[model samples]
Target: MIAARILDPDSKLATTRWWSTTTLPDILGVNDADEDDLYDAMDWLLQRQSHIEKKLAARHLTEGGMALYDLSSSYFEGTTCPLAALGHNRDGKKGKLQVNYGLLTDDRGRPVSVSVFKGNTGDPKTLMPQVRKVKDDFGIKTVVLVGDRGMISQKQIDEIKGVDGLDWITALKTDAIRKLADDQGPLQLGLFDERNLFEFTHPDFPGERLVACRNPELRKLRAYKRKSLLEATSLELTKVRAMVGRGKLAGKDKIGVRVGKVIDKYKVAKHFVLNIKDHHFDFHIDTEKVAAEAALDGIYVLRTSLAEERISTEDIVRNYKNLSQVERAFRSMKTMDLKVRPIHHRLENRVRAHIFLCMLAYYVEWHMREAWRPVLFCDEDQARKKTRDPVAPATRSKTALEKVHSKTLADGSTVHSFQTLLKQLSTIVRNRCRVPTDGPNAPIFDVVTTPTVEQQRAYGLLETIEV
Candidate 1:
C-alpha cells in the first residue's frame, strides 16, 4: 500500500517538523517509512477519491453553463513521472519537473473538474476536454466556456457547439479578427451604431454567434498597437528581404538560401496587417497565408454559442475576461512548489494520490485567494487617497469569488461553525525572562489570551477541516 500522513510541518502531529528547514543538521532517517507515513495516508485518500468518483453521474449535463477555464502544469527533473515527457511546457521550464493540468470552473472560480496531462500539453489541445468534462460530470446544463485565443480552434468550437447547451467566447487573432469589423461589406454609415446589434450566425450551429465589440477605448488601443506592429513587421521584412542570394549578411546567421521563397513568403504574410485599403479577399488569407504568423501575437477572437436569451454580449465579453481568474488559480498551484518534481513514485496509485493532494491544496489556495481578493491586489494606498470605503466594494466589485461551501469535511462541521470554535484555541511562544541563575534556554509559560480577530478568522477556516 502507498504511504501517507499529514505532512504539514506546522501541524500538531508533525514528527518531521524540522524537515522543511533548508539547512538540516544531517541527512539522517532520510529513507525511512512506517505504517503511518504519507503512502499509507494516501491509501485512505484514494479510497475517498474513489468514493467521490463513484458518485459522478454518467450522461451528466453535457450541454450547459458558466464554464470557467484555464490551464496549469508542473515539471519533473527525472523520467519517472510518465506525464513528464515534455512537449508544450507553458511555463517555459520544460527541462525541469513538469506536468500540466487544465480545468473548468464556475462563475465563482470554483473548479468544476480537472484533467491532467504531460507538461508539454498544448493549451489549444486542452479546450475540448475541459468543456466536455464539466458538461458530463457536473450536470452543467448551460455552458458558456470562455478562453483566450490560445484555446480556440474551429474544431474545438465545433465540438462545443456539437453539444446542445454550450456557448463560448474566445479571442481571435487581429488579422483573422478584422473580418468582423465592418460586417465585410457595404454598410451605410448609420446602420451599425449604439442601439443596433449586428450578428453573424451560422446555420449549422444556429446559436453560434459573433458580435463585434469595440469601444472607443478598445479601438484606440488596437489601432495604436496595430500601427506599431505593422511598422515593426515592415522593417523586419525589409531587412530580411534585402538579404538576397549568397551574401555574408544572409549566410552569417545560417539563413536558408531560398531568396525567392523567403521574399515571396514574407511579402504575402505582411499584407495581413499592412494591406492597402482596397484588398478585397483578405478573409481567405486567414485560412491560408496568415494563420500561423497571426497566432504568434495574442490577438484573439471571441466566439460564443450561448443563446441570447440568457445573457447579452457585453456581459459575456466581460465574464470571459474573468477566465484569467482560473489562470491565476493555476499559477498559485505551481508556486507552492511542494517539491512536486522528479515524481519518484512509480505506482499509478501513488501518482493519483499525489495529484489529489495537489488538487486539495489547490482548493484551499483558491479559497484563500477568493477570501482576500478584495484587498490583496488592491492598492490600499491609492484607495485611501480616493477617500473611498472598502467594505461595500467587496460585494460590488466586478470580481466574483467564492470557496466551495464546506461543512467539516470528514467529521462534517460547517466552516462558520468551526471558525467560532478555533478562535478559542491558543498558541504558546517561549520568551526569556532572565533572573541571574537561569540556563541559556528559558522555558516559557502558557500564554492563554484572547484571539486576535484575524487569528480567530484563520483558525475558524482551519477548524472546518476534519482530521
Candidate 2:
C-alpha cells in the first residue's frame, strides 16, 4: 500500500483491509512490523532517500547555468510545528501562522534543493544555505545565485567576496545603486547600432565586478511607468488639493496628506527603499514637487557580480533581473488546490511528513512544467480548447503496464475482471545492486501497474515528453 502511495499523485492507496477478515492474503510471513503501514513505510522511505543522497554526488544538475532562488510562506491552522510563527507576510495574508520555504532551481526550473526558514526569520539569511547546498549536494562548481533585492545586502556582498567562487546578481535597490548611475549625469557610453551593454569592473574588489546592460526598451518602460505614476499621483492630489481652497482640508495633518501625497512636478518622483543594515523600512518618495505638471524620463540601473568576460554586461543585467520564473513556481505551490497547507495529526512527525509530501508534489509539478510548458496555453480559454480536457492522473502510471492482464477469448462471449487484472499486474522487482569503484549507487527497482480502460485511451497524450 505504501509502495503504491509513493507513486500515486494524491498519495492515497487503495481503500481496503484484509486483516479485518483475519486473512493475511497470500503472504507467507506473520505480521510483526506491517510493511504496508504508513508510519513504517515512511520510516523506510526516509532512510532510503538518505542512502540515495550519500551514494552518488557529482553535479546532479547542469553546470555553467544560473540558479534561481526565491522564498515563500504558507499558512498553518494550528500550533503543531516549531517553525510556524507570526511575521511579515509577502502574500498580504499576514497575521496568520505561517512557515517559510526557500527554493533553489536550475536554469530550466528543475528543483535542485530547498531549505525552510522560520516564519519570523529574515529572507536574507537563506542565501548562504542555498549556495552551500548546491555546492555540497550537486557539486556545481560555478553558480550564479539570482534573487531580488529582498535577499541581498552589503553583508551578503561581503560574504560573496569572501567565498572563493560564488557569483550573485540581484536587483540593486534605489539607495545602494542610485549613486553609481546618479553620479554620472544621464551617462551614455555612446549608443550602439542596438543598445550597447556596458561591463563595469570594481578595482577595489578582486574577482568582483558589475554588469550594466543598457536596455532601451526597459528605459522606455521605466520612463512610461514613472510618468504614469507622477500623473496618477498628481491627478489624485489635484482632486484632494483643489478642495483645500474650499476649506475642506484643515490643520498640519491634512496639509501633510495633501502636500506629502502629491508627487510634486519639479522632478520625476520615485520611492526610495533601502534594504540594508538598520534597514529604512518605509516608502519615501525622492522628489521635490514645488510646481505642477512635471515629466522625467530616466534609465534605471541594476548591478551584478558576474564578470564582463563570461556574459555580456547587458545580457547579465537583463537575465539576472528576470528571476520571476522561480517566484512563479513558489506561487503555484501556494495557490494550487493540492492543499499544501499544514494539517498536523497532533504530532510534529506527521506535520513534517505532510510537508515533505507537499514538497514532493511541488517537485513533480515543477518537472511537469519543464516538460509541458511549451505546449501549455498562455490563457485559460486557450487551454480549454486543446486536448479536449485535462489529462487524468493515472494515465501515465497505468499505461506502462497494460500487458499484465489477459482478455477472455471464449467461444460464445468475452469478459474481463478488474480484480484479476490488478492481481496479474501486481509485482515488484528485487532491488538491483551493483557497486563501482568510482562511487556507490542507489538500489534500483521496477514497478508494474494495470490501468483502467479509460486510462489506456489517454496513453498517447501522457507518452509525450519534451527533450
Question: Where does candidate 1 have its weakest 10-residue lDDT segment?
Answer: 275-284
Cα RMSD of predicted structure 1: 11.0
* lDDT by residue (tens digit), candidate 1, 1-467: 11111122122123344443312213344445343575677777777863443233222123444566777666554667666666665566736756766766666565535667766778888887665555555556666677776777666776665676666777656655544333553222233345232445544335566654433444456556755655554555455444432233434223333323433544444444321121111111233333344322222335676668876665655566667667666654454322333355555566666666655655554554445332233221323322322111222222212212322222332333222332233242223344455786665543335665655556565555533
lDDT values of the candidates?
A: 0.49, 0.51
* TM-scores for the candidates: 0.59, 0.59
lDDT of 2 by residue, 264-348 (tens): 5433444422121121112333455311112222233455677667776445654554466676666655554334453433344
Report how far off residue 105 is in candidate 2 (Å): 1.3
| TM-score, candidate number 1 | 0.59
